[model samples]
Target chain A: MLIRRPAGVVFAAGLLVIAGGTAGLLLTRHSTPALRPPPAGVAALPVPTGPIVAPPQEQLDKPAPPVAKPVSLIIPLIGVQTKLVTLGLNADGTLQVPSTTAVAGWYTGSPRPGAIGPAIIVGHIDSVTGPGVFFRLSELRPGDHVYVRRADGTTVEFRVTAVQTYLKDKFPTEAVYGATPDAELRLITCGGVFDAATGHYLSNVVVYGTEVD
Target chain B: MRIVKFQLTRWRVTVLLAFLALLVGIPAVSSSAAAATTTGYVALGNLSQTPSPVDVYLYSSGNSSPQLVEPDVAYGTILPYTAVSPGSYSVKMRTAGSSASSTPVWSVNLTVKAGGSYIVVPLRTSAQAGSLQVIDNNLTTPSGKAFVRVIQADLNQQKVTFHCSCAKGTAGDIVTGAAPGTVSPQAAIPAGPWTMTATGPGGVGSLYVPLTAGQVHTEIVISGPDNSILIENVLDAAGAGVAPVGGVSTGFGGTASHGSGVPLPWLALIGAGILVTLASGLRLRRRRLTAKG
Candidate 1:
């Protein structure tokens, strides 16, 4: 018995595929929005005057030693240990990624990993075949450890402070690359769905770390 | 009869609209001007061991008179940031409700420059008494993160190492060799409840602080004669929990900002760091609370 509606069967199967894909996309997407503004009267103080003692800010020491360039990255938690290649802005002013996805790259514009300011490193999650260098980046948790070897034969260890993900359209630029008072490290990678049309990932995964000195 | 009841004519309506527009536009103009004026910030915290309250006096430089500003600040308490005009100022602490004529317990002078923020805490130990543990709280508050510093103002725990032995990346000595009346440098950590330990020579005291995103905070450490430590987390600046947009052109590699030959990402990141926080209702970055380098 032949029911001659092959086109109808093909259309129904397409619909099911789309329905399941949509459900999966919604289930896996990150939902947290950008930071919300705190309520009023919560930001700062009222009128001034306090106990007649000394000013506490004076206790800080701002001096720092000379910085050394980063040579390699070591994230033992994720089994990532690779030499770092310097990255710069493309002519279009976007940060350049490494030509290959197997090795990670460090953004040359940022300070070195052991420096006083923030140093940034980026990698890919995957390519057409197997897992990329930062495939396990999103699996890192707070209190994890990542190390960077410097040109001066010193290794600076960094502790994970936070792990966050953001939509590429709403990526947190300041949160990932802002100037800090102490030595810090930032790791970046692409995550979420791959857009066949755009040839890019839809989200960015960022990891923040502090020096363990 | 209907025409007699009608009040607003076209001409009259036009005049009323003009007046309302002027009223609305005036505030917009004035608020923009006010945002341009840069002022300094000063936050005060009480870290003494005594139960008696203390009064804080902030006298303008060169003035000898006692001008009471903050009164009855209890131990382990930190007040919000006080917006201050940029200038030299001398602050004094007195016993609560004590007369201005009475002898002051401690005094210190500090310069408040435009856009600077400072935290001042008093020490109660005889060795460091009358001294302040100040940590310059002028750091950028990126979205989704909090900036923090520790003030080792405890009297009994003279020298201590503050450790964050948590399961997360904060598991290490955040501050080392923090002598009494000293403060630690700023550290950026995730926003949440963080448990830390102050390990001194005699005992180990526990501290806990709850922090939110987009603000600067200070954890004041104090101890009684029994060596029991108390920690008070205080807000220094409300950067208003807002993140600065635009950096590194991460997703914009295909956008017009990239192809347009814009000197971006580098300039964009700097702009983001200098962004004035709009969380003004919380007395946030609206006061032009700039950090000193």
Candidate 2:
């Protein structure tokens, strides 16, 4: 007669084998999948619409100097080139635009060059009609370089340190403009996923740079 | 001969007298003709025998450019040696070498008399450690109101205290505005280099305060309290407070006696829950395997 294994041992062995098989199957099923390339021709898309409604007298006025002419801006790492404009307080005490029309410039009311204050520079990421200057501002990364040339022929260079976004209501005004000991630069533009419901941009993109040289 | 000599001597004496009278009369006439002018001086800061260098400038409504009396002078140093006419003047002070980089620490306006000496002391001092009391006089209803208090203590005892007081209703109101409970002296605290803590009726809201002298600074937050409580340094000029100053508000709509509670991040809690569940599942599987073996 053939030797017969105990029923308990046989059952235990059968269960162990089943458990191992199930664990293996699960491990295989839950493995991460490889990333696939985006579909072709996906880069092209319609421009985003923003909330600022044009006034009836929307005729473009003479373009103001991009930031005060005395200051020259250059970002070596990011390949950014622009001028500064002087900004002031809006009628409602909000940040004033350099010009009524779309343009880039430094806020005149802001701190002067080489002064220890928040030097602000604003640019249009995209015009209502299409992409304007600073269209690729969102692509800038930390360690990118920026240079500011003053009228006195002296140039001050800055390095990208941080980039952040905040809702219009939650912008830290004092922290951005209040007195600081070091020379800093702040570049502001609209950012975040565009929302169709609100005419206004969902968030503001602020790029902070510190004087490097 | 005697008569002639005596007459000549008398004439000489009369001429000398006339000359003296003319000299005295000319000064009297000129003094009466001109407008009266007075002189005054404005002394900046506490006048110390050995004054520290204090910048002094003269600002007058009459003049467009403020005259720099002493570009930088010691505490007791006098500036614009000339008397300042009657008018209002503002005295400003900054630590030496402070410019656009460093903001002025003290500024005060003084009304000076036409001919008087005005002594000004721009007290700029730091508070070490002391009890601060904030009394809210806005008691119109019976509901209680919550206020946030930030305390900066040495050795990292940064704490946020919450206090609540009931609104004193009018004697006429029989229902609402009853006397509320005694406000709590402190709020929930966490490990902190805690520079600031803001308390509201809903919970402790956003907070920001600068560290000073290696000590943490505290803030009182009132949620939705439109009116801000003015914290001033009584020892300094009128309306002067510490640097990097801030205020908090009590929230709107609640019974008013609410306090800003300690907030726990939802993401952290969710993560913890997930971790616990995963651990429990692993433990159960191991136990089952051991039991079977």
Candidate 3:
């Protein structure tokens, strides 16, 4: 049987999941004896508070560098290697979906890949024709690798941290789109049961990743 | 016994003294570390009629030295909040990509106060002259208290009143008939979810405003062809200020715009189930034949 909770309850549950994820990060850091302390200068910066989560070490070492446009994305685990296209807000202010089913769209309003904010990329689960590029996006597991090649000839690697499914009505818009202090990635696709009557998926599957290099 | 008791008392005194020293010295050390550089936060916004991008500079001195703070700020876009020190600053605005030696289109001098947070908007004056619109920000919310401030920046609207439909009851006329460039006083209300209603010369509209204890927020109602509410999560010591929360539409329209439909992938599931069942049936038949043979 399918159960539907209030939107507030769903949002709170998402937050709990995210909180558990960061707590696990802290635990892993503490358990690893080989982890080195931050450099003298980095140790001096004010401890990040609030929504601006401190980036992992690789990102902490670099200040706000020149933003590089992402040219391509490669997720080997899901056999996804597709070029990225820029997307903007629609007339109604919602994100514009990619026109082609086989292509993924990155939101232009957010920072580009390898930048100091959450760079959002979204794809359709399936079009009227067939399955889309991110059809198997939900198959991705934690620790799966995602590579984004930038126009500057550098590729930023991200490690998957969490994958969550939320009903479209209860989607945590702020958590998905809000600004972050460090470089992050959110890959989204429509998932859950498909309704023939509505012709739209009921939920969105969001894959959260942190830039490793 | 007497000697042991005396030694124990001495040890307890030493530990208490150490704890007292830490209690008093921690804040002193931290304050002294940051007291040398007094600072405040400031954000920039562009709300001019022109569509061209603007380059904003802050001159601590006269027009001699200019520090380009925000560059290529497109119309209707707001730059991030930054820290600044208390001083007399001359805000200069010019066409983006223009040479530093070129003349600025407009300039305004502001005496910034220490620890003050402000939103500086480059706007056209009543006479159509370029000017700066400074909105002072309040980041003080006592425990279990939240605040709401209204800004009427609708040029065409003659006046607007901000009403609140809060949990306990409705508070009407929180901001009564505020004009352009007018900022309503920050009103303290119980921290919770509020449906803020802004009725103006154009029409009436409402948006959800979630408030938490010890958090302050400012809502600016802008009117024109594209009317919207801009919510600023004012910076506090707790964390970095949230990026400008936009897309709060407030005009003559209902806010029920979300798409509706429950999806059921029963056909796919049924197909998969049938395939699995047929495969298992074939395997069972083959096993029975082998056993019988």
Best by lDDT: 1
Candidate 1 displacement at residue A117 in angstroms: 23
Worst-scoring 10-residue span by lDDT in model 1 chain A: A46-55
lDDT score at residue B39, model 2, on the 0-100 scale: 32
RMSD of each: 23.0, 37.9, 24.0
**Which ranges in model 3 have alpha carbons more than 4 Å from their true place?**
A1-213, B1-37, B50-52, B62-65, B123-130, B224-293
Interface RMSD for all numbered candidates? 19.4, 23.7, 19.9
| Fraction of native A-B contacts kept, per candidate | 0.03, 0.00, 0.01
Candidate 1 lDDT over residue span A33-123, tens digit each = 3322323443232211222111223222211345678887877656677789988767655677767777888877666676545688988
Chain A vs native chain A, TM-score per candidate: 0.72, 0.61, 0.70
Candidate 1 lDDT over residue span B1-293, tens digit each: 23312321432344345434533432110011112224566766567655347887888798887443788877766664566779988877788999976777767888987657776767655553456555566657655667777778776776788876443656467788887767777777767777777788778777665555555666667765566776655555433233323322232222111121222332333223222111111121212223211
Q: What TM-score, over all chains together, does every model reach?
A: 0.41, 0.31, 0.40
C-alpha lDDT score of every prediction, in listed order: 0.60, 0.38, 0.57
**Candidate 3 or 1, higher TM-score:** 1
- Model 1: what is its DockQ? 0.03
| Best model per TM-score | 1
Compared with the real two-chain complex, what DockQ does model 3 have?
0.04
